[model samples]
Target: MRSLHPLVVTPETAEVVELPAGGAFTLLADANHTGGALGANRLRVGPGRDGAKPHYHGLSTELFYVVDGAMEFLLGDRVETVAAGGLVVVPPRLPHAFGAVSGTGADLLAVLTPGVERFGYFRRLARVQHGLEPFDGLRSEQDRYDVHFVDAERWSSLRGGR
Candidate 1:
């Protein structure tokens, strides 16, 4: 059996940040700490707010667990509405997105197996390492860190076959 660490993380070590679409998220275990083992995150979306844009990983599997509030998942032609304590799995290369349906935003826990290299993506959006600044500023600094924007063509390819 695998041994469990008494304390792998603590409140002081948790990384928190505000995301796009007026949502906020916290990073429990990130790439730097996990050595790319996997990425785990907690997200809180306000009422009537959508989650991340419809996108898919080139080679990564992701899971989302709804901790509170009501959320709607959109995967291809199918739509699943889930409440607290529900889970959603998204396969790699499958376009999927979600949003809050209830008046109150939803609290979610997201996990990516084998790590999604999402840290690089979030870092590009954040610009500064310490805190999140303006999006325009982040866009300017993206290429400096070798982060490139995903154009519509590339995004479309991923969105297809959903």
Candidate 2:
């Protein structure tokens, strides 16, 4: 078994996780931890005062375990109000978005299978070094990824009419 001290993992060295609509995220593996095919992370998201335009992933599925505060989840057309002890599963491109709707921000333990490549997608969008060309404005800057919003109920099968 591979073993690494948790102290080995530091914010400056760990990979940075960012999403256009989602919040910031950080890796949780120890510097020496190993033997797993997937990566784990402790994600911290703010109010998300401005909701993400509502998009879905086609290749990767994500899971969220709420650690603190309350969140307003948009899973398809149905909105789920989740609290600190909530758990949410989102299938590939199932049209999901969430943010803290009340009180303090949210802390969650997020797991991504295969790897953190999906996190990379959002990282590329938020990085200032990338020239900020890939991002489409959510509530500002009219130029953004063009997407047709659909009701939450139809999120699972809602990729049509693009």
Best model number under lDDT: 1
Candidate 2 local lDDT, 10-64, one digit each (tens): 6677776664435566766521244333456776766533223366655446678
Q: Candidate 2 versus the native: TM-score? A: 0.58
C-alpha lDDT of residue 21 in model 1: 49
Query: Distance (Å) between predicted and true CA of 103, model 1?
Result: 1.5
**Which digits, one per residue and each the tens of the lDDT, describe model 1 over residues 1-162?**
222433276767877677654677677876455665677888888785666545566556789999999887766546678999999998866766777875668999998865644555564443433355554564464443322333334323433422
| lDDT on C-alpha atoms for all candidate structures | 0.65, 0.55
Clashing pairs in 1: none
Clash number for each model: 0, 7
